[model samples]
Target: MSKDDDTTQYDGAAGGWGSVRGMLSTFREEADSPAVLRTLMRQNKPGGFMCTSCAWTKPAHPHPFEFCENGAKATLWELTSHRCTPDFFAAHTVGELKGWTDHDLERQGRLTHPMRYDAASDRYLPCSWEDAFEEIGAELAALDPRTAVFYASGHASLETAYLYALFARLYGHNNLPDSSNMCHETTSVALKAVIGAPVGTVAPDDFGQCDAIFFFGQNTGSNSPRFLHTLQECARRGVRIVTFNPVREKGLEVFVNPQHPHEMLTGDGTRISCQYHQVTAGGDIAAMLGLCKHLIAEDDRLRADGRPGVLDHGFIAEHTIGFAEFAAMARNTTWEAIEAASGLARAALLDAAGVYMAAERTIGIYGMGLTQHVHGFENVAGFVNLLLLKGNIGRPGAGISPVRGHSNVQGQRTVGITEKPELAPMDKYRELFGFEPPGETGMNTVDACEGILAGRVKAFVGLGGNFLRAIPEQAAMEQAWTALRLTVQIATKLNRSHLINGRVAFLLPCRGRAEEDVQESGPQTVTMEDSLSRIHGSFSTHEPASPHLLSELAIVAGLAKATLPPNPKVRWDDWTADYAAVRDLIEATYPDQFKDFNKRVFTPGGFHRRNTARDRIWKTGSGKAVFTTPTMLSATSIADAPGRYRLITLRSNDQFNTTIYGYSDRLRGIEGRRNVLLINPRDIERAGLADGQVVALESDAGDGTHREVAGLMVTPFDLPDGCLAGYYPELNPLVPLWLHDIHSKTPASKAVPVRIRS
Candidate 1:
């Protein structure tokens, strides 16, 4: 067999010995044995550490090594034995590092010591912490506040996020651009409009109680494997799970939890989905409209029969308004339009609707696939309408759940890490800090890139992320970053963001959450809030890679102290020295939610901030769950030319967000490289294309940009006729910058119109 064929042999099995062997290889090359292991133990415990993975809820039922493949990779990557010492920096030029792959640059290991770009040497030279801070302070203070931007990754702890927010407010700029803008900003925007909150209504435990699950856009088995266990259990209980996505994910079809020893040993994987429907890319609105229309029709029939109304009439009467208009709109919407637009047969949709209506309790879970669209906010709102129609919110078995991608993304947003202006948060800050915060809304990730490219932004300070690769329009993002006066990064390892250096760039080495964080007080613990609004403590099992590395909290405080006017009243140093004090401030700031924050964190599972949705109470202006009338009735497909297909981006099993763990995606039959596109056999024939044919896909949006990718062995599957799919970051350039939701400003990364050229 060829090397590629051998690699494909491991695709979508139990991944037992092969996975262990792969992990061993990764660890052997970059083992975190001594110092790193000692530091890792101090993270996410009651005075401990945080997980470096996505912001999913920490498992309430403790399992040994409660980590996913991506989580394990993230943890190991941080605690790697390899060190990027001053000597290593001296040996490699910034230009040389730029040529490296994402894995190659990170494999060089943990960054040690503060390094500043030396233009003359064309490489980074070790600089003292004090000197680095002094230079950073000088550059930041010199620039107009509006011209400076502070971007944060979700990897940052709450303490660090708080300090960063405080510093940005104090510096007189609310340009607190973050990764959330690129992903779930739509969920936040839509939830706020309909529910008066920006968080999910359901907890992890709610999954156990749900009679059925309606999954939209999210691929749980790969993107969030931990969820597979719950899904598997739900399936065992005979609860149906209906999935709607542009691509049919194999994991969703079948999932075997490796954590379950019995199941793993027996090789008995649970079949997850009762039914899977491949809706057209950007066709969520149509599907939702169809469901709503069916529900409304059912309600009328049930009322006529003298049965209990299908609609939650009592709940609607007491808790919500605007149902009359919304119901009228749903009833008027034609099935022909819904079927034609969604690209699903009317029979298939009605069958799915029957399952939904039959279930007494249902939960709707979505991810970036639903949110990263032109009408993402509307899609979310539509889901809310379906749930509200059945009185699903504020209950044990039903509600909306938007799965967050980053480890502490929810926590970051909870503590004011947003570009959107909030009067309440700003007022509170003013009351506490005695400084008027920036009133104007700041730039998001997309806007930040545009701002930097236009020369409107001068400086960029990223708190732990690979920004250049994360943002769309790679060339423009890189050029804009290089044009900056100063770019400061607080991170564990080298990434593409570090290579795009400014005139005065400082790569500040910081301790990862998996490493022990020791301060003057003692070993410290960080808290992270999960998707379910439950706060959990994380403790690291490893030691610090180097003594010189600083915690994100300490780094933020150090920067603040260096730049801010020296004041006895601020007590910035005290908060930095002891994170417990920072937690105290957080507790004080949100007394209603985080009361006794330090004490509650000691609990194994931690505490949950109560969600009003749990009780079916609508927090909207009318004190009821409201259904939004969509301005458009169908999936807004871009005008494609002859022989063109709409392509959507996907994440492989080995990757998490923008962080690629390995080139092999065993589940999808992809191996060696991320160059192949998943195309329908009919599309292949329609375009006169064959397997292994290298083709350039031209953007149908008139951007004139093209993506070159090789064809794969076409698998005839149940996808929409005109749709094609491929991996992201490689394909992000195909998505136009302007193609985004008006309400959320999240780019339509899931659905970009394109036509293949042989």
Candidate 2:
């Protein structure tokens, strides 16, 4: 077998001995022994810190080691002994540091103290906390608040995110764009309009009861390895598991739970997907429509025979709207169009629908594959429409699950890190803080970039994230990023965003999730909400990497205190000292969701915020769930020219979002390399490209500019014909800023029109 088939040919599973070996390799590289081991043990446990990895739900019951291989890497990556100190900065100028790779910068380790950019020497100089705060405050106070963008990353806790929202609102603008804008914004927009709530209805317990679970564009092995354990259990119970993705990812194939004693001892694994359908890039909406159409046709056939209808007619009539129109649209859709758009035959779609019909309950889980497209909003809505047809929502083991990447991207949105102003509770703010938040809509990630480019947006305050590296159009963004008057990053370590400094930039060092945060009240616990909507407290028993590092809560409060003039309504000092004060404000702002903020979160396993849709209660404008119809076959038109290929950007097994851990992707058998493209053998031959041939990918959006990324090697793999896959951020430059979902404004990273060149 070839190197690409290592996962299937060697171990035949994702998380067997390979996971253990990877964890050990990371620990050795980090060079921290018992301390890192202890930290890993406490991950996702009560009174323990949350994993800095992906936001798969934490189990209600306890485990000795709840973290996965990549989760362990994240924790150790934070706890590394290396530190980026004043001396290190003095050695390297800003220009010199800009040339360093992202992995090299992060490997330099934690930021020890606050540093301010010295333009004269082109180096960062350590600055006193008071001076840094006062200067940042002065800059903010001088600029019009409307022009300043306050961005937050998933690394922040609920308490810190709440403070960030309050500070941004009090500072007089709602330019609170966050990490979600680049990721699951499509899900938030679609689900809220369809079901009245932005979050999913299913909980961790639902996995046990689910008779069938369908995955779309989600690579579970790398993004969320812990989820493989849940799938393993379901597969063992004879539950039907189906997958639809452009790439034949090993995660969706088979898995062996590293924690299972029997599997570990015997070196055996469980099969994951019963039916794996390789849909074309930008073809999820078409595949989703095909499934819906198949079910509708089956229902008509069953009814013609005077038997029970295949679709849940009672559920549709009582709890949903626009069923007749939706059914008509599906019935009108032809199988030829579906096959051409989806790159799947009618037989395959019908076979998948048969699995859906056999199960009493089901869940639809998706990831970036479904969202980062031109019609991402429609893609998500289509998924929901299929579940609604089968009445697979609002009951045990049934619902839609958008498996979020970041640890708390969903939590940040819950606590008000959004561009939409109407989502904020204005009346509640008036009753509690005696100040009205900005009523006008603010900018999202893409909008903020455009604003920066146009000189409309001045300063930027980032809670935690490498915003410059995570977004699309990297080259253009790098040029536009210099327009900012000031940039403040509250983070634990160095990232590419730190290198893209403004005229006045400050890097404020903050404690990591694995480090204990001590405030006036004592060692404090931060709360985070999982993708499943369960709010839980995270405590760190490990010592801080640097004594000078402050908690995110303290840093945000200090920034607010310096920027805004003293106000009796907002207690920045008290909230900084005691985090409970922040929680109290959050409860007041969102009483319905967070009534007992302090008590419930601190309790073991935390409490799940009520999802009204889970109880068959739709809070939409029509007071009922609405069925949506897509007017098109797919997000983007199929590639017409022979050499033209649809591009899909993916994260390697060794990386987490923009953070690259190593060059080796063990599952895919790619070692010591990331700048390579995965293509099908047929496509490679048709394009006249040889295996391991160096090539360039160029994209034309019909604008004068032709975006291109060169020096990428071609590696033929299991990708569908007329489709090519490359690593993200590396290929983000090919994605034009204007090419995005119109509703959510999420960059179309998944389905870019491109042609390969030798």
Q: Which candidate is the best by TM-score?
A: 2
lDDT tens per residue, model 2, 1-758: 24543111223579888888888887888755588788888898877779988998787676788999889889989999888999999999989988888899998999999999998999999999999999999999999999999999998999999889889989999899999999899889989999988989998888989999999989999999988888988999999999999988777888878878999888678899999999998888889889999889889998999999889999999999988998999899899999999999899999999999889999999988888888888898899999999898899999999999899899989988888988877777778888877898999999999998788989999999899988877888888887789999988889989988889999999999889888888888888988889888898878898888988988899999999978898898899888888888888888888998898776666689889888889999999998998888788743457567889999988889888888867777677888898887787777888888899999856677778999998887787778889898778889888888878998888888888878
lDDT of each: 0.78, 0.87
- Whole-structure CA lDDT of model 1: 0.78
User: For each candidate, what TM-score against the reference?
Assistant: 0.94, 0.98
Top-lDDT candidate index: 2
lDDT (Cα, 0-100) at 340 in candidate 1: 76
Task: Tell me the lDDT of model 2 at 364.
Answer: 94
